[model samples]
Target: MSLRADLRVLWRSPGFRRLTWTRLLSQGGDGMFQVGIATAFFFDPTTATSPEQIAVGFAVLLAPFTLVGPFVGPLIDRWQRQRILLVGNLVRLVLAAGIITLVLADAPVWSLYATALLTLSVNRFLLAAMTAGLPQVVPAHQLLAANAVLPTLGTIAASVGGAIGGIATFVVPSVSDNSLAVTALICAGLAFGASSIAATRISRKELGPTHPLEKLDVGAQLRALTAELLEGERYLRARRTPWHALGVMSAQRLLYGLVFVASILASRSILADPDDAEAALGAFSIVLGFAAVGFGLAAVITPMLGDRVSRERWILICLGIGAVGQIVLATAPTAWALLTAAIIVSFAVQGGKIAVDTIVQRDTEDHVRGRAFTLYDMAYNVAFMSSAVVGGLILPDSGWSRPIMLGIAVVYVLVAIVFARTPHEVRPVPPRPVAN
Candidate 1:
């Protein structure tokens, strides 16, 4: 089906529309929250002057959640998904208030980080629930289109939200950095509250594990969770398509993260005056805006080619495109070049992500789908975090390294070649019997 027709079908479904709105509001708030952090923490000349500092900031934000991410999967499977969505946002709303307080009080930085950590941890669960519940709302036949459209739209919403936050910081007269960041956080908190309200519109059990697990004693629950996670690992290993797709996606994300860090440093040190932190922030936001355009293009292009090309083949094509973008960055490390590369590589990453999401959702059973997506999120974040570490170690404060860019381009090509050669078909694993 064409993209328009697929959207028409999905729009008619009340469940899909509600779920989409929930994601948009939630992710939009996430974007605002993150930009506020960047302005207050990262782009601030006093706080982050070196690549190591930037990497540490990301590690503090992401590493804790990545470590504990697996525990969330089983709960997602066991809990009422609608309740998770509703409660998750409410929790974030409360956390945002705490963060705002810390920012205003000029409290210890660790205190601010701690509050942000809790907010992001809840965010992980909320996102996983949305991805797992997608199958329940849309028709089986339209899953691919839904995947292409929904996530792409959500990403665009985030970019728009971030742009708004950036403008908020600049537009308010005579506002301090702390006050501007607080403004963004206030907006984010309101958005989270609104998202929770949207979540209430979806009926309980509308997005489901058709059969939820029974409550258990703490020890028994721990044992069952371990066993279930093992079983999920085995299931994914047995499904070659989703597993391979995940590997390729992770590779791309890793490289993208490297470029991401470079872009930040480049904006701060090379593109804008090093003394002017707000100017650097504006430059980075422009890069993100171009990247958002890439994401939008992928949404339109992926669905248009859905009928003519297999998703697996499309992934390979995207990786190839990413290689070209990386090559462009390596050869010409200018502001315009970075912006052009951002558009190309963001398209590649977003396109490949849409394909990977569809593959995992289509292949995994609902009983374990929550776990599957949690694993997906883990890999995604870990790859990005790892790249930040690597970029910190290898790149200079200026964030321009031709050799590293060329090397990343080479890796992208190699991954595409390896993925194309790998066998995709595997014997299906029967679903494990659920214990009473």
Candidate 2:
């Protein structure tokens, strides 16, 4: 079906519209929230110093999720997803407010970390609910199109939100740490209001796997979840193509994370006044905007290129793009150069992500697909967190190192070569729906 026709169908479906609104509100808030956090971490001269500190921040942000995933999946399956979406957003709203207060009070670092962790945990839960509920609202046939459009829109919303938060820093005090703290508070309010309104638009049970026959006992749910996870692992083992695709994506994320650490260091210590948090944040914001554009372009181009190329070949091409991008950064290492590199690298990473997701959907059975995706999520997060650890050990406080950049380039090229050697017949799969 044509894009316009797909949108028309979505517009007519009240349920889909409500879900889309929910996703947009939540993800948009996420973007702003991230910007606010970045402002505090890298932009604020007071808190910004040392790769180890940055590494700890990254760990606080992502690594604990590895421990949280097993519990999240079982809870997501057993709970009413609509309630999850509503309650999750509400919880995040409170957490955001708490973070803002903590920042204002100049609270201890651990206190801030605790709040951030809880906020992110709720954010992940809300996103999972959004994905699980998607198929419930749209027709099965339109599932593919709905999946593509809604999530992309949500991503765009997030990019816009981040951009707005970045702008807030420039207009507000411009020199005070309180500026970013205020931005975080404003974003928290936006999340609270939008989510509350969106929640009211949908019926409680509209989005569900509502396992009618299952017992609701906690032990039963845990046992079922363990079995399901094991089943997903076995499924991936049997399917080399999807498994390989996942490996490719995981490698890309690790590389991307390393590059990101480099970017942060470069932005914090090299690009602008190291002590001037606002200046560093403003510069970082511009770079982030460029990266978002790259991600947007990837979304646009993937649909156009998906049918024309084999998924395997496309993955190789993206890795090549990344390798080339790293080389560009290595040689120039300026803000503009960083922007240029961000565009290409982000494009490459997002493209690989699209290809891998398509592979999973095409190769996996529908019943176990959710679990498969949960595992997929875990792989990338773990890879990303691992990169922070690796990068922290090797990267300087300034975040710029020629050797590391060169090493990243080499890794990309080698991964591409390894992928090329894998002997899977190339098959084209249409882009599947994704939730951010």
lDDT of each: 0.87, 0.75
TM-score of each: 0.94, 0.84
Q: For model 2, name the residue pairs that clash.
A: 43-277, 265-399
Candidate number achieving the greatest TM-score relative to the actual structure? 1
lDDT of 2: 0.75
lDDT of 1 by residue, 1-436 (tens): 6567778888999999999999999999998888867765579898889899899888887897787787766777888799899999999999999888888889997898788888988898898999999999998778889998898878877877777776787786646768877888888899899999999999999999787655646666666776777777788888877788889989999999999999999999888987799799889888988988888788878988888988899999999999999999988769888999999999999999998898899888888898888889889989999998998899989998999899999999999999999776755898776442
- Please report, as a residue range, the 10-residue window in candidate 1 with the lowest summed lDDT: 213-222
* Residue 309 shift from truth in candidate 1, angstroms: 0.6
